[model samples]
Target: MIDLDKVAHDYGGGALLSDITLRLEPGSFHFLTGPSGAGKTTFLKLCYAELVPTAGTVRLFGRDLREMRRDDVANTRRRIGVVHQDCQFLDHLTIAENVALPLAVSDRDPGAQADNLSELLDWVGLSAQARARPPELSGGERQRAALARAVMMDPEIVLADEPTGNVDWEMSLRLLQLLVELNRMGKSIVIATHDLNLIRAAKAQIAARVLRIKDRHLQLAGADL
Candidate 1:
């Protein structure tokens, strides 16, 4: 569902990524690991068409990103869900409103959304926090809220950047469990993180392939994961 072919990104004279190639299929979960400036985030952005590669190609859902018009990319994005490290949200909006924004933007039936919205909140253990504003939630609550928003569209692909970065071990495990459940339902999942402990934990829950960027190329991560 996601393919990156010989992709490279350059800013001015500096190279952020090079000779990277990857493919993520349906029902597969992947963990992407690398050092601080090793381009893990850049790679994830490439997968979702957030940033165009300075070179090579990114093919998502059979369409070449390079040839896709900007509006086309935006439309295609409806089928993809991304959870960021910062968990962007409107400070004034309630948690439920933020989570339902994706569906609203897609012009889905509001009445039809009622049930799914409730179920999603329950799934993330956020039903009680639905009417609360984004700023009122804790770090873990906000992270799960972000996850719920990402999947609100029932997207075919889910990309999370450092999903458990600001949370404790218990919350991290809770977040991982949510991702695992989504994968079981056939959503393609890619989590870009530098946390080896999280990767180790994930290995025990699902058959996820770990890929890393090193020496300017993408490679299968060591079994140490």
Candidate 2:
């Protein structure tokens, strides 16, 4: 659903991603792996139109990103869900309210989706902590709550950065299973992480392609993954 053609991004000083041509197809699952500061996060940002490439074209849903206006970009983002590395959330809001923030920010009436929010919390195993605030929840709870929030609007694509970085193996697999289930239901997924074991666990359950960013280039990871 997203296409990058010879995409290269420069952060003023130099290019972070060079000659990166990739396509995220419908109903496909991908794992992005790289060392720290290797531009894994940058690649995810490019996918969701958060950062426009400096040297190439990025197309979302067959439309060129460069042609999209401010409102166009905002609307396009609604179709894509993002789970940030920090799990950005309003500290004042409870877990349920935080999960419903997507719907609230969209033009929709948040109250109308109360049932959906509850179901999502249950699905993510955060039902008990719905009344808890972001600061009060554990790392795993926060991450799962973040996932629930990301998908609250029923986005077509889910882009997650270091989603399991702060959690244990059991929680990591739980989150992975949630993503896998979304893929099974036809939502395209791209997860940027350094977790090799998590990638292997996901591979055992589904055919997931692993992409590694090394030497400022994106390539298919070796069989070791």
Candidate 3:
């Protein structure tokens, strides 16, 4: 669903990613692994249109990234769910409202999203705290809320960056379960994390392929660990 051709990205004229070419097929699962400062975030932003490549073409669905206007990029984002390590939320909004914001931002009425929101909250084990504000919820709850918000749009692709960073092991597994369920339902999943244990845990439940980023390069990681 995503195609990158000879993509090279620079920050302040310094290269972050070079000669990056890859294609992500529908319903596939991938994990991006790399050390700190290895350009994983840059790569993810390119995938989600948060940043345009400095020297190559990025095609989403079928259109070239350069051809997409800002509104087009915003619209394209609706089809791709993103869960970040730092789950941004309105401090005053309740968990339910935070999860529903994606629909609100898209101006898509979110018909029956209330019901879907409840279901997702329950799936993520956050139903009991639905009315709580972001600051009141634990780190894990906030992260799950972010996942709920991302998928609330019924996106075709789910991209998570360090999604399990701040949570305990139990909470991490719970969050992973939701992602696994989405993958089972045909959402293409790509997560960037440095946690090998979480990767191994996911491997036990789904056939997820691990891709490591090293020296500004991407390669398939060996499951031999």
Candidate 4:
């Protein structure tokens, strides 16, 4: 769970997010929508402790972000997965190898997690492309691979930033289904996206709360949306 209290973050120029207090409970699903430069990315970074807030507090799973040491932060990160907008992968490594990179980075042997990796690839519908390189993949395939990589460690929370931004409507729904599946399995899901249609689609399958950032604040989106 992530708890933010009166969080205000400024990137030198001005306050990007201000007076934001929110809590992500276990098994909760949320969609964050806002205009470009509205601090959606900043909010996600703060949630995962990638950037410390300029003011206020952030506590992840009951531990204060400001109080955690480097090792503590690294360890905390293992419990949370992130899918970035840009699905960057090493061209030399096969999709399977790239998906298993997180295990290696965590000092866990990839060989030990072969079964899990295989299952994950299949879950994301990328089993057929397991040996393909990143450059050879379509946008949907790349995004699916990125999703596989993010959850390789079996994280408790999954934060996706514009996960379906590059894919078509069909592919977007496919990716959304995967996240919804994760939520059903008890992983907290937070997706930062501008696509209202995607949010509306998710609402039909799950009780997803939609939040919007405006005037440097976070508020629950109207039921009409």
**For candidate 2, lDDT tens digit of each residue in 1-225?**
899999999899899999999999989999999999999999989888889999899999888999999888988888999999899999999999999988988898877887999999999999999999999998988999999998999999999999999999999999999999999999999999999999999999999999999999999999988
How do all models score by TM-score? 0.97, 0.97, 0.95, 0.96
In order, candidate lDDTs are: 0.91, 0.93, 0.89, 0.94
Q: Give residue 130's error in model 2 in angstroms.
A: 1.2
Worst 10 residues of 1 by lDDT: 104-113
Clashes (N, CA, C under 3 Å) per candidate? 0, 0, 0, 0
lDDT of 3 by residue, 149-222 (tens): 88988999999999999999988888888899999999999999998998999999899989887777777898
Q: Write the per-residue lDDT of candidate 4 for residues 1-225, one digit (tens) a residue.
A: 899999999989999999999999999999999998999999999998999999999999999999999999998988998998888788999999999888978977767888999999999989999999999999999999999998999999999999999999999999999999999999999999999999999999999999999999999999877
By lDDT, the best candidate is 4
lDDT of 2 at 55: 89
Q: Candidate 3: misplaced stretches above 4 Å?
A: none
User: What ordering of candidates by lDDT runs from best to worst?
Assistant: 4, 2, 1, 3
Worst 10 residues of 4 by lDDT: 104-113
Candidate 1 lDDT (Cα, 0 to 1): 0.91
Whichever of 1 and 4 has more lDDT, that candidate is 4
